[model samples]
Target: MSAMKEYALGVCYAHPKEMYDLYDLLCGWEIAERAVEMEIVERFGGDTYPSKDMFEIMQGIADILENIPDEEALVMLKMVSLITDKPDLMEEELSFWRGRCAA
Candidate 1:
Protein backbone atom coordinates (compact mmCIF):
# COMPACT_ATOMS: atom_id res chain seq x y z
CA MET A 1 0.00 0.00 0.00
CA SER A 2 3.04 2.28 0.00
CA ALA A 3 2.11 3.46 -3.48
CA MET A 4 -1.15 4.62 -1.86
CA LYS A 5 0.46 7.94 -1.00
CA GLU A 6 1.07 8.88 -4.62
CA TYR A 7 -2.50 10.10 -4.95
CA ALA A 8 -2.97 10.81 -1.25
CA LEU A 9 -4.59 14.00 -0.02
CA GLY A 10 -1.62 14.58 2.27
CA VAL A 11 0.44 15.68 -0.68
CA CYS A 12 -1.66 18.83 -0.85
CA TYR A 13 -0.64 19.87 2.62
CA ALA A 14 3.13 20.28 2.81
CA HIS A 15 3.23 22.64 5.80
CA PRO A 16 3.90 20.90 9.08
CA LYS A 17 1.98 23.51 11.04
CA GLU A 18 -1.18 23.67 9.02
CA MET A 19 -4.14 22.88 11.26
CA TYR A 20 -6.33 21.38 8.57
CA ASP A 21 -4.05 18.75 7.14
CA LEU A 22 -5.86 15.44 6.40
CA TYR A 23 -2.76 13.28 6.99
CA ASP A 24 -4.15 12.28 10.36
CA LEU A 25 -6.95 10.63 8.47
CA LEU A 26 -5.16 9.49 5.31
CA CYS A 27 -1.60 8.45 6.09
CA GLY A 28 -0.84 4.93 4.87
CA TRP A 29 -4.58 4.48 4.42
CA GLU A 30 -6.96 3.90 1.54
CA ILE A 31 -10.43 5.32 0.96
CA ALA A 32 -13.71 3.43 0.62
CA GLU A 33 -14.31 1.66 -2.70
CA ARG A 34 -17.84 3.10 -2.80
CA ALA A 35 -16.32 6.52 -2.81
CA VAL A 36 -14.59 5.30 -5.93
CA GLU A 37 -17.90 4.27 -7.42
CA MET A 38 -19.34 7.69 -6.81
CA GLU A 39 -16.22 9.26 -8.22
CA ILE A 40 -16.23 7.11 -11.33
CA VAL A 41 -19.78 8.18 -12.09
CA GLU A 42 -18.71 11.79 -11.82
CA ARG A 43 -15.49 11.23 -13.75
CA PHE A 44 -16.97 9.06 -16.45
CA GLY A 45 -20.51 9.09 -17.74
CA GLY A 46 -21.91 5.95 -16.14
CA ASP A 47 -21.90 3.74 -13.01
CA THR A 48 -21.88 0.22 -14.38
CA TYR A 49 -18.68 -1.65 -13.60
CA PRO A 50 -16.95 -4.24 -15.76
CA SER A 51 -16.42 -7.75 -14.38
CA LYS A 52 -13.17 -6.61 -12.71
CA ASP A 53 -11.58 -3.18 -12.90
CA MET A 54 -9.70 -1.22 -10.23
CA PHE A 55 -7.69 1.42 -12.01
CA GLU A 56 -10.48 3.91 -12.55
CA ILE A 57 -11.95 3.14 -9.14
CA MET A 58 -8.84 4.20 -7.29
CA GLN A 59 -8.35 7.34 -9.31
CA GLY A 60 -11.95 8.37 -8.65
CA ILE A 61 -11.67 8.01 -4.86
CA ALA A 62 -8.42 9.95 -4.77
CA ASP A 63 -10.00 12.75 -6.71
CA ILE A 64 -13.06 12.87 -4.41
CA LEU A 65 -10.89 13.03 -1.29
CA GLU A 66 -8.97 15.89 -2.79
CA ASN A 67 -12.02 18.14 -2.44
CA ILE A 68 -13.51 16.94 0.85
CA PRO A 69 -13.45 18.88 4.12
CA ASP A 70 -11.35 17.89 7.15
CA GLU A 71 -14.34 17.81 9.49
CA GLU A 72 -15.75 15.22 7.14
CA ALA A 73 -12.52 13.33 6.53
CA LEU A 74 -13.18 10.81 9.27
CA VAL A 75 -16.68 10.08 8.06
CA MET A 76 -15.43 9.77 4.52
CA LEU A 77 -12.74 7.39 5.73
CA LYS A 78 -15.31 5.24 7.48
CA MET A 79 -17.61 5.25 4.47
CA VAL A 80 -14.78 4.17 2.21
CA SER A 81 -14.03 1.26 4.50
CA LEU A 82 -17.64 0.10 4.69
CA ILE A 83 -18.17 0.20 0.95
CA THR A 84 -14.89 -1.10 -0.40
CA ASP A 85 -13.61 -4.64 -0.60
CA LYS A 86 -10.52 -3.71 1.40
CA PRO A 87 -10.08 -4.04 5.14
CA ASP A 88 -11.06 -1.17 7.37
CA LEU A 89 -8.28 1.45 7.65
CA MET A 90 -9.23 2.67 11.12
CA GLU A 91 -6.00 1.27 12.58
CA GLU A 92 -3.79 3.18 10.19
CA GLU A 93 -5.72 6.39 10.69
CA LEU A 94 -5.45 6.02 14.43
CA SER A 95 -1.73 5.42 14.12
CA PHE A 96 -1.50 9.03 13.08
CA TRP A 97 -3.61 9.97 16.06
CA ARG A 98 -1.31 8.02 18.37
CA GLY A 99 1.78 9.66 16.90
CA ARG A 100 0.25 13.06 17.42
CA CYS A 101 -0.54 12.20 21.03
CA ALA A 102 3.08 11.17 21.62
CA ALA A 103 4.47 14.23 19.89
Candidate 2:
Protein backbone atom coordinates (compact mmCIF):
# COMPACT_ATOMS: atom_id res chain seq x y z
CA MET A 1 0.00 0.00 0.00
CA SER A 2 1.04 3.60 -0.48
CA ALA A 3 2.93 5.06 2.44
CA MET A 4 0.48 7.91 2.70
CA LYS A 5 -2.50 5.61 2.74
CA GLU A 6 -0.73 3.48 5.28
CA TYR A 7 0.03 6.49 7.41
CA ALA A 8 -3.57 7.60 7.30
CA LEU A 9 -4.82 4.18 8.33
CA GLY A 10 -2.23 3.87 11.08
CA VAL A 11 -3.06 7.28 12.47
CA CYS A 12 -6.79 6.80 12.18
CA TYR A 13 -7.16 6.67 15.94
CA ALA A 14 -4.65 9.34 16.88
CA HIS A 15 -5.68 12.72 18.26
CA PRO A 16 -7.02 15.21 15.72
CA LYS A 17 -4.26 17.61 16.74
CA GLU A 18 -1.62 15.22 15.43
CA MET A 19 -2.91 15.68 11.93
CA TYR A 20 -2.73 19.42 12.39
CA ASP A 21 0.88 19.06 13.52
CA LEU A 22 1.67 17.15 10.33
CA TYR A 23 0.01 19.88 8.30
CA ASP A 24 2.10 22.51 10.01
CA LEU A 25 5.30 20.58 9.38
CA LEU A 26 4.43 20.12 5.71
CA CYS A 27 3.66 23.81 5.36
CA GLY A 28 7.09 24.65 6.72
CA TRP A 29 8.66 22.27 4.21
CA GLU A 30 6.73 23.81 1.35
CA ILE A 31 8.07 27.25 2.27
CA ALA A 32 11.56 25.88 2.53
CA GLU A 33 11.22 24.20 -0.88
CA ARG A 34 10.14 27.48 -2.47
CA ALA A 35 13.04 29.32 -0.88
CA VAL A 36 15.47 26.74 -2.22
CA GLU A 37 14.04 27.06 -5.71
CA MET A 38 14.29 30.83 -5.61
CA GLU A 39 17.83 30.73 -4.32
CA ILE A 40 18.89 28.36 -7.09
CA VAL A 41 17.32 30.47 -9.83
CA GLU A 42 18.73 33.73 -8.50
CA ARG A 43 22.21 32.47 -7.69
CA PHE A 44 22.77 30.04 -10.54
CA GLY A 45 20.83 31.32 -13.48
CA GLY A 46 23.37 31.10 -16.25
CA ASP A 47 26.56 29.62 -17.58
CA THR A 48 28.39 32.04 -15.33
CA TYR A 49 27.58 29.78 -12.38
CA PRO A 50 29.96 26.89 -11.78
CA SER A 51 28.55 23.44 -12.32
CA LYS A 52 30.27 22.14 -9.19
CA ASP A 53 28.60 24.73 -7.01
CA MET A 54 25.24 24.01 -8.57
CA PHE A 55 25.71 20.31 -7.91
CA GLU A 56 26.54 21.00 -4.30
CA ILE A 57 23.40 23.09 -3.85
CA MET A 58 21.26 20.44 -5.49
CA GLN A 59 22.83 17.72 -3.40
CA GLY A 60 22.21 19.66 -0.22
CA ILE A 61 18.54 20.04 -1.07
CA ALA A 62 18.30 16.40 -2.01
CA ASP A 63 19.88 15.36 1.26
CA ILE A 64 17.32 17.36 3.19
CA LEU A 65 14.49 15.69 1.31
CA GLU A 66 16.06 12.26 1.70
CA ASN A 67 16.46 12.55 5.44
CA ILE A 68 12.71 12.68 5.97
CA PRO A 69 11.11 9.31 6.63
CA ASP A 70 9.54 7.85 3.51
CA GLU A 71 6.04 7.97 4.96
CA GLU A 72 6.50 11.56 6.05
CA ALA A 73 7.95 12.45 2.68
CA LEU A 74 4.89 11.07 0.95
CA VAL A 75 2.66 12.96 3.34
CA MET A 76 4.62 16.16 2.78
CA LEU A 77 4.35 15.79 -0.99
CA LYS A 78 0.60 15.33 -0.72
CA MET A 79 0.29 18.37 1.52
CA VAL A 80 2.38 20.41 -0.89
CA SER A 81 0.10 19.37 -3.73
CA LEU A 82 -2.90 20.64 -1.82
CA ILE A 83 -1.20 23.85 -0.65
CA THR A 84 0.43 24.96 -3.92
CA ASP A 85 -2.68 24.83 -6.12
CA LYS A 86 -0.19 23.58 -8.70
CA PRO A 87 -0.41 19.87 -8.14
CA ASP A 88 2.72 18.73 -9.96
CA LEU A 89 5.22 21.32 -8.81
CA MET A 90 6.81 19.49 -5.90
CA GLU A 91 6.84 16.11 -7.57
CA GLU A 92 8.47 17.43 -10.68
CA GLU A 93 11.05 19.79 -9.21
CA LEU A 94 11.93 18.04 -5.98
CA SER A 95 11.81 14.58 -7.52
CA PHE A 96 14.25 15.70 -10.16
CA TRP A 97 16.72 16.78 -7.52
CA ARG A 98 16.10 13.61 -5.54
CA GLY A 99 16.78 11.55 -8.65
CA ARG A 100 19.99 13.43 -9.30
CA CYS A 101 21.29 12.74 -5.82
CA ALA A 102 20.41 9.08 -6.15
CA ALA A 103 22.44 8.91 -9.34
lDDT of each: 0.42, 0.42
Worst 10 residues of 2 by lDDT: 12-21
TM-score on alpha carbons, each prediction: 0.27, 0.26
Which ten-residue region of model 1 has the weakest summed lDDT?
14-23
23-102, model 1: which lDDT tens digit per residue?
33333434335544554454445654433334444553455466555444444444334424534454544454456545
- How many clashing residue pairs are found in candidate 2? 0
What would the per-residue lDDT of candidate 2 be over residues 1-103, giving only the tens digit for each residue?
A: 9986677545422322333333333333434444344334443453334255445544544454555544554444444344443435534544443444344
The regions of model 1 sitting more than 4 angstroms off are 1-31, 43-84, 88-90, 97-103
Candidate number achieving the greatest TM-score relative to the actual structure: 1
